[model samples]
Target: MTHNPSPRSRFGIRFSILARRWRRALDAHLAAAGLTDATWVPLVHLRESGHAITQKELALLVGVDGSSLVRVLDILSRQGLIERRPDASDGRARLIHLTELGEQRVTEILKALREGEERLLVDLADSDIATMLECFDKIEERLAPATDSKDTSR
Candidate 1:
């Protein structure tokens, strides 16, 4: 007999494909600004944080490994986009800060991202957007326990 999959399984596969395509589209859109998903993701997270954060915190926020984040951070540092400052409270820790130029780049990035999102989502009605967000929120909430369990297991 041929194996069959449920709607939930198909939903998961579609969601993953959608996420990958979205990232690729954003990467292309940000190419003119010299930003890729790898680089701009960290920068956007840093800007949203509004204050310097530790590498570990950023790694978690960006859903990347520490070593991977370090490589990206090194590139950003060389580009004068970010600075790693010694944390005052913890001598062993460093806080990542966006340089003046980095802040300006992030502003431009945000504007570009907004325009891109508007273009893509323009066909969707307000209620459709709201419902999609609600569905995503519910999925995130449901996944929290699985995430927490894995984190604790490690």
Candidate 2:
């Protein structure tokens, strides 16, 4: 068998390919719940928090720009899945929460995600799964400090 040393060295390229595949798989799972992978974190946060969270906070948590988050919130609201209201303490800011429909849908999305993940990782042993998650966590921990330092210098 021909060895693929190129891929072995290009970790970023391999990670990108895997990320795309993971996103595609997640999108397919989400379709059944009438949601998309983009909405997953936002909805889960709202449901789990059980209280309205600031739009800015949500944007940061989801790693999206405020304007883009505004658009997504608009669409979700129009779909009757979420609602936004003025923050009581901060009039200039808005708070976001999942509607009852949103709660139901988010629940379904979680279920779909669990099933999707199970199937996706069916070939890997439990130990492999743990190692994979740990590796990603370590990568993020090491890179985040470098990223933060660079941002501060600029």
Candidate 3:
């Protein structure tokens, strides 16, 4: 016999669809700068952080595997958007930092991204947007425990 999925599962699917759609919208906005979603995300994280960030920390922030992150970093470095340097605290570890060009690009890209998000949320009331963000934060927190458990198991 086939088992039926619960309402929560259906809601999860809808959430995923919405996320993909929004990501596509944001990607389109970043494309004008010759950047993809993958490239822009890590750069933005590093720029905002305003200091040398470890590669492992960047990978975790971007939610990408080490190999994938290495490729992404390679491309960004080739583009002169970022640089990698030996970590002061760890001889074997490398730290990533946004270059001058990267910081400039990030500033421009962040402006576009903010505009895109604002346009996307234009139809929603301010209170509704606030509530939506709070809900998203709650969902992230709820999933964190499961994610930590899985990591520990691995």
Candidate 4:
């Protein structure tokens, strides 16, 4: 008798493969903007913030410790993509903001990322893409419930 893999196992394997390929392509595109995957997370957070933000807040947004986040921020600063300034209200706190050049580079990186995602799904029909999105939404809703304890009721 032949054995068949469980659906969960197949899904996990495919997800891993797809994630690696997607990240690899995205990383290459980001390199042209003088950035890397390591720098992308914080950069995205800063871009979304749209104005000067505090380092402590940025750390929370990036989900990293102060020491680690400092290293990434240093790299970005060295590249002239970001700047750090003292907070007027706080004596010791620092504020961060993306430079105009950083904003432009991020725009290019975003465009490249969109194109890469489209390329990855090029073989799928529009209907398939819609179905895949719907299934993913349902799966996420089931398995990745809201983090708030009140939402989970457990």
Q: Which stretches of candidate 2 lie over 4 Å from their true place?
A: 1-8, 45-52, 146-154
Model 4: ten consecutive residues of lowest lDDT: 145-154
Per-residue alpha-carbon lDDT of model 1 for 14-119, expressed as tens digits? 9999999987777788886676889899999999898999998898789999999999999999999999999998999999999999999899999999877887
lDDT of 2 by residue, 1-154 (tens): 9966775598998898989899798888777767676677688877777789888667766778889988888888998999888888878878898889998888888898889888898899999889989999999999887766754423
* Residue-wise C-alpha lDDT for candidate 3, range 1-154, written one tens digit per residue: 9998897778988889998999899999779767788889999889767788888778777889978999999999999999999988789888998999999989988998998899898889999988989989999999888877755423
Best by TM-score: 1
Each model's C-alpha lDDT? 0.90, 0.82, 0.86, 0.81
lDDT of 2: 0.82
TM-scores for candidates 1 onward, in order:
0.82, 0.73, 0.81, 0.65
Ranking according to lDDT, highest score first: 1, 3, 2, 4
User: TM-score ranking from best to worst?
Assistant: 1, 3, 2, 4
Query: Which ten-residue region of model 3 has the weakest summed lDDT?
Result: 145-154
Error of 2 at 80 (Å): 3.5
Name the TM-score of candidate 3: 0.81
Worst 10 residues of 2 by lDDT: 145-154
Off by over 4 Å in 1: 1-9, 152-154
**Model 3, position 121: C-alpha lDDT score:** 88
